[model samples]
Target: MAPTAFLLVFSEPGPNVPEDEYNDWYDNEHIPLRVNTPAFLNWTRWKAVDGEKPTYGASYDLESYEATKKAPYTTLAETRSDREKGILANIQLLDRRHYELIEPHPIPLRHSTTRRNLPHTSSLSPEEDFNKWYHEEHIPLLAKAPGWVRSRRFILKDCGQMGVEAQKDQKPPKYMAVHEWASMDSFKSPEYKAALATPWTEKVFANVVAKERRVMTFVRKWARL
Candidate 1:
């Protein structure tokens, strides 16, 4: 089977609209429209933790680049256009990124991970804290989890704003960390649980990370190149 790719979209609530309303619009209209698209495989949504303002995330999976590229125009261009007109019409666009799945070793699993833009904050000490914890601690821990598979990270240089304007008082982080898990169940394994429960996790997160948002979903293939 061809590996799945993920399209991640990140954004903050608009100036005049309320977060709840935006979320409702997404759940009721946007998601349905995307799923209804011809090549769309699966979708999911998540909210950011520690975010100064509400942060929303969505994930879309397609069989292959060819399928992904062709599906929207063939199946749901009209629906997508309508959705863009409503929810995304006036909202401040934050970030968008495309990710290709990492090939798993030993196991036949396929998955990809990507990070949208991240906001900057004075309290966020990326050099001494975030980077250290992520590289030294978090990555290693996840690697040790059950069904451990190949993983990769990417930094989106020109993705867009990441809710920084909502909190004008703080500076946004220059980088975002993206992690790929072989399977959702693997991430939920006992080893993973213990890793996150450790003091190291607490120490790493202490005062550095204000919020985090994540979403997971299954993928389907429409066309392959």
Candidate 2:
């Protein structure tokens, strides 16, 4: 069976807009509009644990690639367009992207994860250091981590008009990557603990990423056909 995928949006409204007001608009108005759409299957919202700014994360899952590819966009498009026209008319308010599930290697259950690294903003300069650690060190170590099946990584290219600007010219992030896990408990495994204890993982933290990073996690929900 094909796995469900989500289009995620993480946003921080304009400075003048109160966080509660933004949350209210999203929970009361925007999310309901999207959920009512034929293409949207499930929706959820979350607040960030660490940010001083009022942060909001929203997710929308589609039944399948074919279903998502064919859904009516008039209402969806107009709603997003109008929102952009409002408080976010000029500022880029959030990180947005689409994620799909891939088969896990050794495990029977499905697993999902996505990673996005901000360019130039990362504390780890000369990204090659981070790259080497991720592919050469981190992945190999993770393979031994329990419940880790198979993992695939992809470079996010342009989403065409699906991006915030709706202009092909507006480039979002310079790079994006993803990792898959067999189950949520995989993180609690001994192998994963050992991997985190490794020197490579430590170096990655001290050298690559800045204190601030944007990470999002989601649970896959198989949509009804």
Best by TM-score: 2
Candidate 2 lDDT over residue span 106-154, tens digit each? 3232343432211111134347776676667766777787666554433
Model 2 segments beyond 4 Å from truth?
A: 52-54, 65-69, 79-84, 90-92, 104-192, 197-225
Candidate 1 similarity to native, TM-score:
0.50
Per-model TM-score versus the true fold: 0.50, 0.53
> Hey, what RMSD does candidate 1 come out at?
8.4
Off by over 4 Å in 1: 52-54, 71-83, 105-225
Candidate 1 lDDT tens digits, 1-225: 443555566677677456777776777666676666545566666555433444666656645545655646345534455535555556765555555543322323233443222222122444566556665666577667765543443332223334434333332344444444545566568887876787766776675644443533322221211
lDDT of each: 0.52, 0.51
Would you give me the overall lDDT of model 1?
0.52
Model 1 worst lDDT run, 10 consecutive residues: 114-123
